[model samples]
Target: MSKRDYYEVLGVDKGASERDIKKAYKRLAMKYHPDRTQGDKDLEEKFKEIQEAYEILTNDQKRAAYDQYGHAGVDPNRGGAGFSGGADFGDIFGDVFGDIFGGGRGGRQRARQGADLRYNLELTLEEAVRGKNVEIRVPTLVGCDECDGSGSKKGSTPTTCPTCHGNGQVQMRQGFFAVQQTCPTCSGRGKIIADPCRSCHGQGRKEKTKTLSVKVPAGVDTGDRIRLSGEGEAGENGAPAGDLYVQVHVREHPIFVRDGNNLYCEVPLSFTKAALGGEIEVPTLDGKVKLKIPQETQTGKMFRLRGKGVKSVRSGTVGDLMCKVVIETPVNLTSRQKELLEELDTSMGKGEEAAKYRPKEKGFFDGVKKFFDDLTS
Candidate 1:
């Protein structure tokens, strides 16, 4: 069969981007792989055609040569003195996975790093403010003991893959181009296990739970992550383990709400206590302390207790706790108590000047009357 133009064979323009070429090749490779098609000769021929088109289009020098003199000019094995070497499998690997997979363009791959881990830590408000040492149980992937992560049988070691010659890559020649890519045979690990280890099932890793003690610093808030090095999943082939990150989350407090470093709380005072202000016990993290209220202290009045809040981890500065008072309306009142309150109300209702102590209450009533008048009008 006469060779089709390489671009025409791939169904792409000659000026197609490298990405487009790779995408086209990947699609064709997956669709027409010999293993996928079994004994189908037509699919195998189509696969070969795609491989040839990709081989030429992905290369610069071979592509330049082929553009000038077609396939005859860039044939590496044609005994042509002017033709340079074509693409190798390694070249394509560097373009595809890159540093993200840490599969670099180095002559050989370095030791692979272990996996990272996440550990969620719960803390109470007191513990978060004062700091605590906690023991956490974590599930991790550890190296197998039988073969020490070699993925081999008890008495044997893993063998280098013969298909790709232990380079973990294979070279496929379609026409004028030769590209280096990862060896599909070994999945780029450069070795294969004939008799897989029964414990880890050839993956070279095992599941294990380990306990670790972590010290939470004082004033650490939710969303703060502390990194513990070499505490994550163990790597294959004795590679270094990755890091473990402990993410802090503070538990909800019944008494206090946190705003940054400051703590806020609503403290309740009875009507008599609010009317005739007196010292009352208020709750604090440490213990109860007597707080003084001026005579005739009103509801919603805030009292700041300095140094009763957080000592921030970053700033190391102490914050304050703000306590707002809410005057309790004496509900479920006894008959005598209700009668006495009605008598007091009659006394206060005698003159507006005598009811001067209830300015906000009077203003609210005035606003209510105005609202009624507006509604009626």
Candidate 2:
């Protein structure tokens, strides 16, 4: 029987790009793999045919000859120079399944870096505004001193694995295909410890507490991180240690609330201070400053204290502190004080001067009267 077209066997068009050809082949190969088919001879044969098609179509020279003069031009059985042996099959299989199986040229794996760690550092609002260097205690894995991280007893070293002969990989034959996998005996270490260390028990690491100092930059808010390199858990064997991340969490201040670079706070003003005007002391991050209340100042008035807020960590721009004045009513009253207030209230009765003195109150009452009148009408 004549051989089928390579593109037709892989279910791709003749003009299909190399990417499309590989994708079609991957789908068919995965579908017809003997491992999944479970010894079905027909499916295994189909798989072989698909592999043959992919091997030819992916090769530049063989694909060119096949495209111009068809299969006979490059067929090895017909004495033409094509894939006469399975020289490139390993490369193809690795390219397809290497990620899934960790397949590669066999050798001992590198020592993996230790896991990164996070430490939540709570900071006061003042501390976040001003930078501080803090020391922290961390419990993590460190190299064992007993065997010098070699995982063997003193005066003895690890021996090469007998099963894989230190290659760290063994071959699994799937029909004509040989898949390289990590050796079961050595667990890919390529070495066996005859006598394990008493302290860390051949793991080469032990649990210990380490003290590290972290420098936190100024104006750092919540969620900001300071990285301390090589301060995390020790690596396996002799690999480099991971990093430590100090995550900042700013505690809520009772006096002020921060918004980006700005600060906001409500200031309680006495009724006398709001009406007669006075110099009131307001608390700031730096120090107390006197804010002059204007004569006849009303409640809910906002005062901006420029350059009195936090400086941005990134931009270094200063912000203003916003103070909203809230007029406070006196709780305890004397009979004489109540009498004086009554006299003052009578003096400012419903008149033109009363409208000027209490414009907001008069306007609110006028609005309420108009609303009720509209409802009745």
RMSD of each: 17.6, 18.4
User: What C-alpha root-mean-square deviation, in Å, does candidate 1 show against the real structure?
Assistant: 17.6
Local distance difference test, each candidate = 0.79, 0.82
lDDT of 2 by residue, 1-377 (tens): 78888889999998887768878988998999999999999899899999988988876556876786677557655433333212133433443465345455446644567766779999999999988899899999888899888889878899999998987777777777777777799787888999999888999899999888888888988756788888888887777887777888999999999987889999999998899998999999999999999988888999999999998888999889999999999879999999999899889887667998898888998899999999999
Candidate 1: where are CA atoms >4 Å away?
1-112, 153-157, 194-198, 365-377
Q: Mind sharing the TM-score for model 2?
A: 0.70
